[model samples]
Target: MFNLSYKAQRYLILFGFLTIPVVLSLMFSYYPAFSLLYYSFTDWTGLGWEMHWVGFANYKEVFTRPEIFSVFEHNAYYFVGGLIQTAVALFFAVILTGKLKGRNVFRAMLFLPYVLHSVAIVIMFKNVYHSEYGSLNLFLQSIGLGSWQQEWLGNPHLVNVSLAFISVWKFFGLSMVIFIGALQSIPADLYEAAKIDGASGWQAFRFITVPSIRSVIEMMMILTLTGALEAFDIPYIMMLGANGTDTFVSKTVDMAFKFQQAGLASAMAVVLLLIVMFFIFIQRKLLFRGGE
Candidate 1:
């Protein structure tokens, strides 16, 4: 028998305990994803014991089909909407982190949305966007902007945009909180030093604040991209059972459960996963390459 040092034996025991949960978690979490990837190349309907391997048929179909293309386009729209919302959150975060009154109150209010259940929020917004008796249309009419009132989530043309608005409202609070935390972590001494060196407010922000919070900004960007790519709940709940508006952005769950096209849905899921991984890789390369 081989004898190990006391430190080495302790390390082995610690590693065993720590690695057990990690191994179990990976099995449960990643096994489904791997199964999805495998099923994407098959003709499985997510039922029965029989499944035929179809190779790249799913991928070929997704690319050649107009509906799939439309879904991808709507996904792009979702990503853009998320980006705009993140920008708005960053703006508000900067203001709240600066010398301002009632900053804590504002932060709490902004963070309130993030703590609510997403389904509840979506249901609430659905009523709010109703065409006739909705608060939004009523407010528009009261403000003499009745011409702007239209079927928000019902109109095919405006459905995506309307969903985007709700997505922003629900998610911007999280980005704002993240940005606020990042901004606060930045030292005030840096700003003071810049001031003493005759730097303007804008210059200080550009050089000191932005640079100091680069890592957090990068992390948030990755998170926003992933969230946008996987966005399903709001769009699905908003446009449930609606025709014409059942494009790619709102068809993922329906494709799997309603149509029983599990293979195709899994293919689309794989594509979305690839997109998220690509963005994460690009962000890592660009933002986290050096120890700056």
Candidate 2:
């Protein structure tokens, strides 16, 4: 038997620790991703091994079809909701970071929804959005505002908005928590210095607070954008993508599972991945360029 040096033994131990994770990643993540890319160019029905090469046909269908591309319009609602959610989260984060009475309780209340089961949340909202028996409509009626009641998940015009609101409500607290952490890290002396320099509240927040938490804000924005683009849970669980509430991910799922068009679904998945990557790239560029 040969004796090993300390550095070599350390390297061997590190390699052993990494081996399982690296192999698992390759098998589960990379392999499926590459297989999806390959199947995008084939006529695979996602069953058995009977697939034929049909290059670009799936991609062509994805791009040329009006109904297919139109689902992105639904995604826009979630994007808008995400923007609203980010703003609200930032506002609450700033407020809670201050010397407010019982701010911890408020923070816990806000964050409770995020920790709940997603299915339970959807089911809870389903009852809340029911036209006749919903809590929202009932409250409106109790407040003598019965005229404001409408089909939240039934009307095509308002369905996406309702679903988007659910997403915002579920996720905003997480964003608020992240923002709070970032805000808390900013030095207290900076605010004092700004006060000493006769900086008004708005002026200090604009110049000092914004710049200080810019990176956290940017990260939250990216998360919001991606979450909006990949929105599937709220809409799918609530209405199964009915009444014009279908997002890009839901549509892709329908193509693959419901329609048995795995190839087209793969194409759509690839397109979604590319779109997400493109936006992330643009975000990084803007961040590094400092809005230039």
User: Lowest-scoring 10 consecutive residues by lDDT in candidate 2?
Assistant: 283-292
**After TM-score superposition, what is the CA distance of residue 203 in candidate 2 from its true location, in Å?**
1.3
Residue 118 of model 1, lDDT score: 77
Point out where model 1 deviates above 4 Å. Answer: 1-12, 241-250, 283-292
Instruction: For residues 85-189, write the lDDT of model 2, one tens digit per residue.
Output: 999999999999999999999999999989988899999998999999999999999999999999998889898888889899999889999999999999999
Clashing pairs in 2: none
Error of 1 at 25 (Å): 2.5
Model 1, span 126-201: residue lDDT tens: 7888997888899999999999998987777887877877878888899999999899898889888999999998
Model 2, clash count?
0
lDDT score at residue 66, model 1, on the 0-100 scale: 81
How good is model 1 by TM-score?
0.89
True-structure lDDT of candidate 1: 0.81
